[model samples]
Target: MTSHKRKTGRRRAVIGGLSALGITGAAVVTATLLAPAGAASAVAAWPQAKGSKPVPASIEFSGTYDGKLQRHYGTGALGSDGQDESQKPLFVLKDGAVLKNVVIGAPAADGVHCLGSCTLQNVWWENVGEDAATFKGTSASSVYAVHGGGAKSASDKVFQFNGAGKLVVNKFQVSDFGKLVRSCGNCKKQYPRTIVINDVDITAPGTSIVGVNANYGDTASLRNVRVHGDPKKKIKPCVRFTGNNTGKEPKEIGTGPDGTTCRYSAGDLSYD
Candidate 1:
């Protein structure tokens, strides 16, 4: 399908329900902020869906698709929230596509797939299936941006970086998940991955925030990260692994900021 470009000088559309409060970004800005030890921060409340829609097949979207805070769930062939690796996504975004103000419901399948550089703005996942979203842009310069939006109940991963490129996630919240972002561990072809996460809220009962392949020279930069519930700091901030092209499970090397692979300081993270 042909993908289009967003027109210049166009006013940004209001993310339904948040429009009245002047919250123009991907998430709802709440006055109650989580004071990150030494870092500045603001927490967000999850947006409520305006309605719900059932998707039977992957909807190929380009340019801009505003869901108006509607919940979209998989059905028929797209139905299934198992650990199957072959699950189809509810939406397939072409290069330069923008999917905004959307909420993915249960039986989410793969949730969303970005075939190339794309922006997922203010997109929430009520119950992530398989994974929330996968980045498949092959170009090193390609960028996958997830701005605003919160995800909960992700069994394994929230964002899967399978292809080469940079992933920027800002103003996001996640809870009850395994890993927030994971670089391709055993993809037949691997490339150095870059991840930037800022102003994010992470609730406990989670594993790690970001996992990267140190062997592949992947890097993850985190700032203004606030953790809730976990006082013992059981949730790892960053995890490093020696990834391989073979399908076998990758070997975990270590965890925490190495200043190289995991770029962050003690001030960059705080718990409450």
Candidate 2:
């Protein structure tokens, strides 16, 4: 497959997920605004639309799909909110799958459930009923350029990692939410999860970039993350680590204007 590039004036063109097949430097994602419900701060970093290629035919849009072999999801959706909507991950991926060019308009309990391993690119969520993505039970996954917000049903966290081996998220742009990323308690020593978040841009206020909880045994590395909101009302220690932490203290860069630090390292948890 040949990957073509489309230059639109000064705007950056975003390619599709077909690049996963073998092609590279084609897939792209455009930033969109959050809901108008005073949910998030405004960010005028990127445009809302970018050009890209069509999705592969190996994908489908069923309410419930079990990815025991290999599959892909790249379509509008089916059903309504709480009624088999496309945004909901009624599909189960126990093996592996790829999700691209997905626009979830309705709200659902869980966005995408990765039981095994998965890759998500250019996926957007408009109004989520719950967490955007969840990794649980020894799952390993990677996500890139995921944009969306507006937790109408619940003040849900965007990404939740309960128990997984390795999870990597990059270029994640969150318009607003309760918390950006979370590492669940009850971390198993056998699993020993490692989470790496890079280049995360958020506009959430009065909430921790990472939820404060017993994040045990997991090693988290956050680099080049930027949080925009009221520094006075912002969540302190953007990253929190509690419990039997045997891993290295998280590393972070930049801080909010109100002496808002980034992580809960032993000596670097607080600033003013």
Each prediction's RMSD over C-alphas, in Å, is 9.1, 11.4
Please write out the lDDT profile of model 2 over residues 1-272, one tens digit for every residue. Answer: 12222233112211222122121332223321122111233333432434322222223232323232221223344223342223445333443455555554443335666655555555555555456676654543332222222222226576677655656555556655666666653334324455555445556443656632323344555544556664564554355445333444333333332222232232322122
lDDT score, candidate 2, position 95 = 38
Poorest 10 consecutive residues of model 1 by lDDT? 6-15
Which structure among the candidates has the greatest lDDT? 1
lDDT of 1 by residue, 141-217 (tens): 88888877999998899999999988988678999999999998999999999998877899989999999999999
Clashes in model 1: which pairs? Answer: none
Pairs with backbone N, CA or C atoms under 3 Å apart (clashes), candidate 2: 15-26, 15-27, 15-28
Error of 1 at 35 (Å): 11
How much lDDT does candidate 2 score? 0.44
Candidate 2 ranges beyond 4 A from true positions = 1-91, 137-154, 186-191, 212-215, 237-272
* Best of the candidates, TM-score: 1
Whole-model Cα lDDT of every candidate shown, in order = 0.85, 0.44
